[model samples]
Target: MIVENKEFHSRICVDALENAKSVFSPLSSEEKQLLLEQMIAHEFKKGEVIYRVGEKPDGVLYLVHGKAKIAKAGIGGREQIVRMAGVHSFIGYRALFAEEESYASATTLEETFLVQLPFETVVSVIRSNSDFALALLKSFATDLRFAENRTVTLTQKHIRGRLAESLLLLHKEYGVGDDEQTLQVLLSREDVAKFSNMTPSNAIRTLSAFAQEGVIALEGRAIKILNIDELERISRLG
Candidate 1:
């Protein structure tokens, strides 16, 4: 959506600016406002590529709204989705900080809104603020830890264990419904498969197995947990 002349400093812009601080903390009040002055929100359509692998890094991008998936194409042209991001998530910082090409492709899994920070200002902020530099280090370190856990899940776990863990992660990321059962975000079988490191056929089969075993209840895109305790047991056992 285009910014209206009357609402240039709209609440959304102010909110996004505050959030920018969480990602780039070295920004002083004056500096943040200055960077905010340069920011313009961009909307993305569903299934659009925000950036592709091997492209030179330019700016830091944050999801102001919606979801994105980072994926890589493997041997035989199979695409493996590595991560899913939601509103307020940090992305594209690795390549920007490293001053290299992006290692993975980022695409909109749903319609998205983003706030892009100019590269020149990013470098300046990092240089001027020690706390901001530490914030970046902690942020990247947290991401690395999550990535490491995901690697173990994909490489070591059995199919059932992986799916159970994937569902738990999704629930943790989104939340359980008021019933304390259904996953908050609806997903296609293929997307679920990608997150669980399985094929679509395997995802479907395992979901069915879970349903029959009273591990979960599935109705179309909605999944409700029948026995979260058992699910946790499976995740732990894996």
Candidate 2:
């Protein structure tokens, strides 16, 4: 379930809107204040669906805290994770910009906080601010580049290489824990398989192989990179 947080004036929400990469950053103070007044803040529990495939976007979504995954369901009800979003990231904007229903679903990986900017308000700002429009275009271009790279990784890489790359990606996005080895984010085995574009059994086998090779250490959902160089080599060779 999702809870609507009435305290939209919280510092995190304000920072999310005013941050350098924010779409609303180019607006004047008065404009931003007005926009904030119309925004809604939502808190979602771990595993809760933020939005589902085919749903119409009500607004622009900006993550203020926690992690989430954007994925699409495939044949036989299999899921393929397209991307993982962290704090300060934007999700669902692609469909909103295209004026179409969402092609993928977004779900929280942990307890998450988000600020939603009303669609009409965002549209009005884009029309009045050329800089904001350009920013949006740049964001679109960056997302396209990532999509292109991921397409190659999923199709061309071997199972081992795919899992290695997925682990590396998680390390990059969430970084390490206090030990400087274990990843901070913990994802279920199914999520790992979906993100790596492989079946759960395949993913599990590959992970065990890596563990035996001393490339990584796994403790339940916690993954520790014991040999970053070897992991990178696998990804590069694939």
Provide the TM-score for each candidate, comma-separated.
0.88, 0.91
- In order, how many clashes per candidate? 0, 0
Candidate No. with top TM-score: 2
**Model 2: which residue pairs collide?**
none
Candidate 2 weakest ten by summed lDDT = 1-10
**Taking the tens digit of each residue's C-alpha lDDT, what string does model 2 give over 106-163?**
9999998888888888888888889878877787787788899999999999998899
Q: Write the per-residue lDDT of candidate 1 for residues 51-163, one digit (tens) a residue.
A: 89999866778777778888888889788888888776778878877888898998887777777778788667777888877877787798899899999889999999999
Best by lDDT: 2
lDDT per model vs. reference: 0.81, 0.87
- What stretches of model 1 exceed 4 Å from their correct place? 1-10, 19-21, 24-27
